[model samples]
Target chain A: MTRALYQFLLWLHPPFFRQRFGEEMLWIYDESAATHGVLALFTDGLASLARQWVMRAGTWKLAVAGAGGLLEILMAGFFVMGPAPTAHVAATQSIEDPAQFSGTWKGSLRSRPIELVLAKEGTVWRGEIHFQSPDGALRSAPLEDIRVAGDSVHLRVQVDDSDMTFSGKLVPGTLGSRLVGALQATADASDDLISYSTLQAFHA
Target chain B: MREDLSPLVPLSPAILHILTALAGEERHGYGIMQEVARQSEGQYKLGPGTLYDNLQKLLEHAVVEECSRRSAADNPRRSAGDDPRRRYYRLTAFGRRVLLAEVARLEGVVRHARLRLQTNNPRRAS
Candidate 1:
């Protein structure tokens, strides 16, 4: 089953990519699959998808062919017939019930006020962030990978040239308030990692 | 006129690690991955996707080249059991210079950060 899933993920990648690094990738995946859980494999598959997208962006051949359009469609058909990767693994670790996240969260980092408006979407939490850019201009970006696992709350927001990830504990504060315990935010760029800290509070 | 390395300044961690991995000896993809993990103390493990993408970029930049099997044989250090299908890569002269320049640039940033930190926390400075 794992082998079939691995092959399906590999098919999602471009042919030139398979021609070059396919064997090595499979070798590594086999080793990793033996140790890591299903979540990790799914994460790797997502990473492979990102790499394929990058390749398509850089190469006209893949872009023009829609990354081997017919092959991808056939592969997708096969994938639909199989159990989805998401079905096998719980992506988010919900520490606090997502229902408790209904409200507005306001925090300040690097002297700029950041606001989060979160609401429950089925079993998961979804939200948008409003913040001031370096230029002091207001901007709102969709939250990416918002997860509440155990006492930890993790969310990623895309900023220009980088992605800012926040991982910290959720502290139940005074009535109608949720305080972020030891908030640590890391802005990851291709070349650097910049970090910031903030005292976060959300009010219902 | 010389080619400008400025455009490549503040090189991505992946590119820097690849160049650093190839600094002492030419390595195939798997070797490069192992060396980079070792260098980063397992903090930055490059999956095949990330590894090959950076390699493709490096090849395009003319900073790294894929060596032929004959050249690998010339090394005299490579093991006889080395896989023939494995493609080895090494830094070109230009790549070495870029690596050095990037290191220097990073050092400058570190120095500046230190100075600012000292100013921000005078007690720590003392």
Candidate 2:
């Protein structure tokens, strides 16, 4: 089952890591697998494997005992196993309930283009906001203190030491088809919450 | 001596979050992940690999250190309910200084950028 595959992934990690965090990783899998979804869990496992290998790059520890035999068996196993099961609960669930805020909302704040990506996991809502600089590069930040009331939404993004709070509401029809509001940054409190609308065209 | 943190200024976001989380209190791997997510209001998430590898480097650099149960016992705030088997880490004094320096450096950059912005667009001045 998924448990065996996860265990196999864990086994591929360097021994030093397996010795340190093997049980804790398994414990987390047991506790949050249902919440984080199967796909995210496997992705996390793969990330851990890559990290351990990369960090041990220069050490003699790279020559792990039994790794040669293990790799041969794994390649054979990969040929035998079919496509991996995927649970996209994070994507699908974000469309339901509280995650109605989920999507890519693109617009301009004070004439600067910004993009916000929102998703919900378990009860926690997490996402990032990317602001395109004048040079065409983008500097992004994570959204914080997300509060929703009726159709109104409020979120904050920290830019260095300053905080910009976006106070807006979803244009009603169904879900967050459109969002209109003003983003007032704390750095310029004297400024108004200049009117604007951000289209959620990136994600349906 | 300037105690040059120029070499460490502009830390990667991952390292910054990890250091900030440990600054609040010592924590295990899961605790650190949860703390970063909670601190940033669920916006920033650290995967197991990202957490440990950066943590390993921080440990190697001595900015972060493993805090065994006996070491954690000295910390009055550590809860009794914490699992004894889980390893905990905390930011060292040097790490705190580095974080503060980074913050200060960022503030200066923001300030300088703001001044330039106002100078470029006189009407936007506030």
Candidate 3:
């Protein structure tokens, strides 16, 4: 493993340097293998690459790398120390008959057709949602943290790389009646809505 | 702009070690590695990747340049039967100044740390 890592590190050098000093580098590796070992070699290889990137990369590429590294840290921190769930809608009492909300309902938001399949599990509501993504890819996302309270129903799903919370009123009426509500899509920690759209559902 | 100011002040350990090893005499790559390990008492060692990469940087910075005159007797790591393509490196004048400045900075840091340690320890304070 040490020999292989040493060869890999040597290969990272530019061709001209490799041609000039490759043999001497190998000799050094052989002499210092006992002291440096494989782990140190691997760490040095990474450090060498990072230094090369910082020194050699163009301004644009350096900016992109900086942004990418920052984004990764922010994303990891977001998950580890996620924002408290801000209630997108006022809480209401749990539905007396959650079973009435069960069955498939069709809706549209921003001109995109959406399908919602709701089911009652004892006192709670469970659902699955299907919609066409922005890239025109059909995505079926399981709705989570579903709560059905009286005439108000709320559920959350991940869409378009954003957390989308859909809260609407389920009015018991004729079979062809309309269910109306609003959708809140948040993309980051601020919990501010990136996009808010009205949602209308009809039994399909 | 401070154009005359040296850009190598905040030298990395690997670069500093390489410069220190070559300060007294010109040595090959392996020679630098062995000397650095010996100088640090085996506590800090530079792997071949790190050593060569910093050597490239130092060459670009003109702080150190390659020398072609190779004598196997000069480097104990090179055997009599070994290939004679050993590349030797020596620190330029600029590198010497940088090394001195960095060493002084390190000395100040070490002195302060030692003083604090002794002051905190009542037995040592006496």
Reference-based TM-score of each model: 0.50, 0.50, 0.46
Worst 10 residues of 2 chain B by lDDT: B60-69
TM-score of the A chain in model 3? 0.47
User: Candidate 3, which CAPRI tier?
Assistant: incorrect
Give model 1's docking category: incorrect
Task: Please give the range of 10 consecutive residues that has the lowest summed lDDT in model 3 chain A.
Answer: A86-95
What DockQ does each prediction reach against the true complex?
Answer: 0.05, 0.09, 0.16
The CA lDDT of each predicted structure is 0.67, 0.67, 0.68
lDDT score for residue B15 of model 1: 89
lDDT of 1: 0.67
Instruction: lDDT for model 3, please.
Output: 0.68
Question: Which pairs in model 2 have colliding backbones?
Answer: none
| Models ranked on TM-score | 2, 1, 3
Top candidate (DockQ)? 3
lDDT string for model 1 (A1-204, tens) is: 877787777777765456555666666666556544556656756686676666433344334454355555567678777633431122232235645666787875444687888777787788897887667889898888888755456788776666666654455544554545323235445432233333455663
lDDT of 3 by residue, A118-137 (tens): 88877677889988765688
Error of 1 at B88 (Å): 1.2
Tally clashes: model 3: 0
Please provide, for model 2 over B47-110, each residue's C-alpha lDDT reduced to its tens digit, 9 standing for 90 to 100.
6666776776675445776664466667765678766456678877878998999888889999
**Model 3: per-residue Cα lDDT over B1-126, one tens digit each:** 333434677788788888889998888788888899889998877777678778866764557765523332556655777655466677767677778888988899999999998889766454
